[model samples]
Target: MKKIIQNFGTIVLIFLSSFLFSQNTNSSFEIKNSSFLLNGKPFTIYSGEMHYPRVPQEYWKHRLQMMKAMGLNTVATYVFWNYHEESPGKWNFSGEKDLKKFIKTAQEVGLYVIIRPGPYVCAEWEFGGYPWWLQKNKNLEIRTDNKAFLDECEKYITQLTKQIVPLQIDHGGPIIMVQAENEFGSYVEQRKEISLEQHRKYSYKIKDMLLKHGITVPLFTSDSSFYFVGGSIKGALPTANGENNVDVLKKSVDEYHGGKGPYMVAEYYPGWLDHWAEPFVKVSTEDVVKQSEIYIKNGVSFNYYMIHGGTNFAFTSGANYDKNSDIQPDLTSYDYDAPISEAGWATPKYNALRNIFQKLNNNQLPEVSKPVKVISIPEFKITKTASLFDVIEGKKSIVNNQPVTFEDLNIGSGYILYRRIFEKDEKGKLEIKGLRDYATIYINKDFVGELNRINKKYDLDIEIKKGDQLDILVENMGRINYGSEINHNLKGIISPVKINESEISRNWQMFPLPFDEFLKHNFKTKNIPENVPVIQEAEFILDETGDTFLDTRNFGKGIVFINGKNLGRYWKVGPQQTLFVPGVWLKKGKNVIQIFEQLNSNETVKTIDHPILDQLNK
Candidate 1:
């Protein structure tokens, strides 16, 4: 009797083992008439979106594990062309920018991969993910079939595919799908001059280029219903975005694919993106759950736009403007109010989604990984200060007749100073032309007023003395990320400065502040004059290093640096009061913190374990 009982248990274990093996080894991926087929069996793709560059490289595996633990079988990501190729000839595929490593880690963490390699990925990124140098080509009409733009696109695709082709499902890897041109329909709608026919040809060319460079996975295009006509390729599977109605999505994709359907909502917004001065967005969890239930029950595949919204670290955040031309600049913290918070804590939505996904499988999901440790740094004071004026004092000035733009000066990111002396005692409407973003005005070291492109402040009245020096410090808040403004988005003083009727174009002392070079040269820390842009630094010792949020509540608008690595920008505004500091960038013994404060200095900094992303300015 004992032997019979043991034999029965052994047989039951073997049967379950065989079933799990079959599930793990399914390789062939196909887009069938009704649904996706894995090894000839219907498979439902449950995906979540998280960019590799946004999450620190060290935290990549943990985040992927979190995705899988939440019952997500697939991870969707975007490859920003600008992130890999900073300059035209220069390339960076190392460290956090390693595309191959990011993909392999996803596979290792038990998740299928879907990549969107966009030469233009409008992810609220700078220039919509196009390299800034692309604008330098005067003859090239971007997002079109022009030779210059096409050539660059081909080169980027060819180089990137070399790393991706080997990972496709056909090659026994986890990659199941690759996205073709990202939302061409949306671009065509924005720029009316560029016709649908032109973009259609461009989309076809891009699709062919992807195949020529060695992409074997099934290709898909994502756009809304109105854009499907112009944004889709004939051969690629059609997918909808931002559509909440599951029935509507099925109908639209069915029509696009000739009545047969494998529906997918490529970008379902779980939380809204926040811009400066606007209230922080907190999406309704009940609404998300309701829509998700509908998608699953009706055999629809959908991916959360951002399952884990990471930090934008550095000045990589972008801005937006609508037809009204009201510019809305994005905040640095991208804590998109996702189920997995910015610091990696699991929100209530995560548990809710997990419950829904678990109902589909008989076996329990993988256990959730423990949260990454967080440490709080004691408040520290900025001991040393140096004015920006003192740093650029001896740097060579480009004596240009007209104010040169950032692209014109060949400085990709940062601030530029435009100086002009009042030749004679005259006061009129002091104005600037082509104000790219934000600027601070000064008269002979005295603060004048501010010039903001978002509010469209063109000029201000001023009273001047004969020798009163005019200084305009312009900061590139961020480029206009989407819509019709791409072609005209250049930072710094773009055109000649004018005082009422007279255009001041001669001997305009234009100084491109080289903080790196100047800081290395001298940049002595001492007693600097107040009310000027100052460079301040402080150091704190950490016994252990983990993810922490830097509190910038007391300080004014400026950038934050952690141990020489840019942590991104901070403003006194309410929405984003803290900057995420990845533990990978900190050291155990000591860590250096620096700030280039443009306004009043608090001379103090603090670190909190959690993020404060939703608070509006009080």
Candidate 2:
């Protein structure tokens, strides 16, 4: 009789799952009695977050496979708008930007997919993943009820959905759930520029847009428990973002879900993101294990916010602002101190969680894959160096009657030089009205001083002759990725120059130094002056191709390029000192290295096996 009853129970469970899975036509996912029913069976989703744009194309398969071996059934990713469409109407989905290939890879890896398609993904990315061109639309208000902003979002979603809708489970692919605009609750609460009604309209409008764009999968909104009021959709599931005391999490979702179940922590943060000067964030593995136990015991579904955080690479990093000081630019290496290291090595946390998850899965999890090879390159010497002034001899500059912004000139990333010949001999506190970030001030090609927006320093006392040239070389540190500050982020010298109380508002020669173009220009190699920008080049040989970190501790501030591909920013200022160089991007024989040093020189650079992401300013 006991045997018969046991068999009957198994059959009943299967029946329940099949019943729920078929009930919803739009989505096979359903909520029933505090459980997620998939194809008539209770399903617990164990997921991880990793961005495709963050990891190199060659490593996507490895990373997704690692996720499955670590006991994850699903992988969640955010489709960054700016990453796919850098400029207006310019769309790129091939190669690394191929969203379809990434999703297909996850499916091939035997894992489910949860896509967070954000017009605003706020992953500490430049301008919260909104393209720099969006700022050009003067009247467009982001994250609110604005026609221009919504119009662009609509067009973007339409373009993006073409990649997603084809891969949904109903269409015989792996994608199971889709997220509406990311964490709108936090934004609505923090932004005072928009009204509660306007914010509410904006949030729902995004959900509507997602539906309009043909995303047929289950839609959900993610925010902390306290933010459910502003972040949730009417018929869609509401999932919490950070910790919510299990009881609160279940209660919040139940209230919003018509007293249903299938409670999910959509973004369970295991570790934290490290900014440029901040301490390396390391969450205890033991604590994470404990939380996993609670979720399993309570019959909850959860996804690690970032099971793996790859490199930010290039100018993709973003800045954070506060009411007190200036912006805090994020580090290029987004290690996130996760279970899997940025270099794709299995960490202690990975082993610890694997043990727990294996037990939960009835010991069905696979063994963790071997890590990618990491090689240490011997120090390589510099081959050539060129002066910035000499390199820009023939480059044209916009002769503006008044100082303009990066967006006005369609210059996205890199540096901008604003030159002005002093009309007459004058000396006062020199100030740039809207210095976007950092500036290196020079008097007649002589380095005089430096100003940094991060320090909130704008003015410097200076004396100039009538014929003396005043040059302000400014770098667009990065744009704000979060909160109300995102609305005001504009690069370069945004406004007029000021001398104490007097304003200098005429005859500014603005030069856009897009480093991408510099590689094509013939640099007149010569002796460079001290404390000014210089382009340095070198060649290094490798017997085998593999992953490595280029140590930049010896160098000051600049960008690194290996074989003409950018490895991203490196500053002596602490937190991140090494940039990851993917093995796939290197040739076994010879590789060219380029460095645009805005500060001092380093005779040679060493490619080390380990990354130094915790170093502070020396």
Candidate 3:
């Protein structure tokens, strides 16, 4: 009797093992006649765009689950070329920038993947994801037949393929399709069709390269909406962008492809991104719920452009092409007023979308978690102990050569300090042309000048008295937001050292931000100055990860970072005072906090529970 029972158990175990193996090895995805097959059957994709590098690691699972609960079956992401390779042979895939982990997590939550590995993706990212260092190469004309650019692109694609190729349908993964160079035809004029043909050639080249590296998924190109009218085959999946309106989606379907195949919305708008001076945008949750319902009812597969908008962090955010009237630099916080805010909280829009998805099906949704906690610290006083001159007294490099633009100097981002020694008895008009943004002039360490964008010129005329040396500091506040001239952006002293419209020949010393140097420098404040503010450092314990706003009411204009994560610029006088720290970057243990206060010796900071968007904007 015991032997009979054992035989039955063995049979059951064998059967279960066979079923699991079959499931893992099956290619449930299929493509036929330009339609997608989900689970070996035709299925329309409801997709959303959320780059893995944009959001933090801790929130990846939560954001993916949120999308699933919002009626989206797929998540679309962009593989930023420059992000993977910061310098020429160096690659980083850890922390918030981990792409493969993000994709696998999406699959774990029952969501398919559409990878847009753009060698050139103009998603409003800095230089469209091309490394800033690439621009330094003298013989490169980005997005063209530049050998250097193409060679780098190939290397990046090869490395990325190793991570994603195995995750395709044939390998029991969620990736269904990969997009070729995004929106190429939109920029090229006159020879639109010819440009598209060129795009097709490159698209196939990338496709072949990926296949060589073992990615066998179908490839497609997102064409210009106008060009498609001339019989251009837009993306293999018959994709249309910004098709938020139901009528427009239907019209686009019939007009573009004769309404034959699956209808898809490649880019759906739920909210908008705000600039530094712009008012905080509050999107209507009702509008999102209504539009989503309409899309689903009409059998249209749509994806939110940013269901979970995350921070642009560091120098990665790109500007819009609005008219050149405003200096609308892309702000550090890419909150976007999205369904899931940059900080990763489930906003009212998330809840509304979740309810709509639940109503559409009987699928039991995952439990929604509570928001993270935020703590505030008591006010502490800070005083400046040293000046720039005192610290780098003898180590400054003086430039006697020709003046170079910031771009010419190859200084892409951050602040640059320029100092020159002026004879005490000299007085003349100190005019500086081509200044990108802001600058401050000092005569013998006494502040005597200020220049801003509204002034529209870097030339400053000042009276120079005898017995004083001249020191000037400039900051690339941000490049002008719009227009063709953006590519020529430079930070410090574009056309330097001018007196009364004529150039002044003097020994000029340049100090490029010294970010790493500052980090390693030790404080040697043996005697406290009564009026100067001190650069302070402290440590804290974070029990949870959530959105945090650093209150910089007491500190002047400068930068702050917590646990090596940049919290953005803070100014005691200006429009944005509090910096938003996304919950995902915070850890539940000891963390480092460092600050470079501008002025006003007394520095007291605290982290508040709520976002300071409304308070700061108002």
lDDT (0 to 1) per candidate:
0.82, 0.84, 0.65
Model 2, 327-346: lDDT tens per residue?
88888888898888888889
TM-score of the candidate numbered 2?
A: 0.94
Give the alpha carbon lDDT tens digit for every residue of 182-284 in model 1: 8888888877787778878888998999999989889999998778887878878889989888778878888888788888989888887888767899888
What TM-score does candidate 1 reach?
A: 0.94
TM-score of each prediction: 0.94, 0.94, 0.84
Top model number, lDDT:
2
Give the worst 10-residue stretch by lDDT in candidate 3.
480-489
> What is the Cα-based lDDT of residue 267 in candidate 1?
88
Ranking under TM-score, best-scoring first?
1, 2, 3
Tens digits of lDDT, candidate 3, 1-49:
9967765775565356434533575766666654667666778777878
lDDT-wise, the better of 1 and 2 is 2
| Backbone N/Cα/C clashes per model | 2, 12, 12
Each candidate: RMSD: 3.7, 5.2, 6.1
